[model samples]
Target: MIRKLAFLIILVGLGFAGVGGWQLWHGSVKQHETMKKAQALTVTKKDPVKYKDWDPIKGETIGILYIPRLDKKLGIVEGTSPDQLEKGVGHYKSSALPGKNDQVVLSGHRDTVFRHFGEIQKGDDISVDLPYGTYTYVVDHMKIVDKDDRTIIHSTKPKEELVLTTCYPFSYIGDAPKRYIIYAYPKKK
Candidate 1:
């Protein structure tokens, strides 16, 4: 009986290992392909409107985001989604655009969407290439605000800046109460 039980346990362990290995292999392959496609994207320069003026990203598409500290370079999307964020970028309607008014707020997933975001540090370089031009920003600060903190997401400052948001505590299994927010200012156009 002991031999049979031990043998069963070993088999189960091996099965688990196989499953884990397969998942890791699959994830790496998918990210590699995504990186290839993202790298081939056509990037645009940042178009800066006058301080009080406004202009949305042409084509309503942000090609990609390059962060030196992150493990992956994500592709930006027009809409928010696990799929879109997983690739590297997402859109938030309420936030302003490159040269638009208010904060250029955007949303992304913590682990899958903007996974490398967890590695972002103050002063890190964040380069966003829009249809009009490339907008560069530097990480200034980060905080975990509650979901009700609409004021953070509802900024209307007439300047070039970026506010990136995602659920907090990267590995949190349940609905997150606080949000992980990164504040960056436009460093270059």
Candidate 2:
């Protein structure tokens, strides 16, 4: 009976390892493909005349978020719905887009696409490549707030800003109640 139990334990452990390995493999492949697609697409800034009128379809890729420190580049989709997020970072439709001179908020799943987010440090540079231009923001600070925090949406006037958010407690297994917010500003020439 002892030997049988040990064998069963070993098999269960192997099964768990196999599942983890597959997840890692699949994630890597998906990321590689996203990067490739983003690289192939040429982005130009939105025309000023139509900037305010611009609207995107829910799952459409709107921009690319590139973090120099993390060496991560992810496509930014138009909406924050589950389907959009599953592909990459999702841009909050209600917020301004890149170069709007207000809050441009983005969100991603910490466990997958934004897993390296915790490695970002103040002064790191983040670039948002839009269809018409590429805008870069220098990291200012990071803060943790309740998931329902409303202050994050308040506008910071006269400055082009970027806010990237992910669930807090990066490694937590269950639904996280806090948010990890990274604030950055336009990189000065």
**Candidate lDDT values, in order:** 0.68, 0.83
Give a tens-digit lDDT track for model 2, residues 1-189: 999999999999999999989976776675566556666553444565665666877877776898888888898778888767767888888888877788899999999889978999999999988766788999999999998997898676666789999999998887899999999999999
**For model 2, which pairs clash?**
43-131, 44-131, 44-132, 45-131, 45-132, 45-133
Clashing pairs in 1: 45-133, 45-134, 46-133, 46-134, 74-88, 85-113, 102-156, 102-157
Q: Which candidate's TM-score is highest?
A: 2
Off by over 4 Å in 2: 1-33, 43-52
Q: What's the TM-score of each model vs. the native? A: 0.67, 0.80
Candidate closest to the true structure, highest lDDT: 2
Per-candidate Cα RMSD to the true structure, in Å, reads: 5.1, 2.8
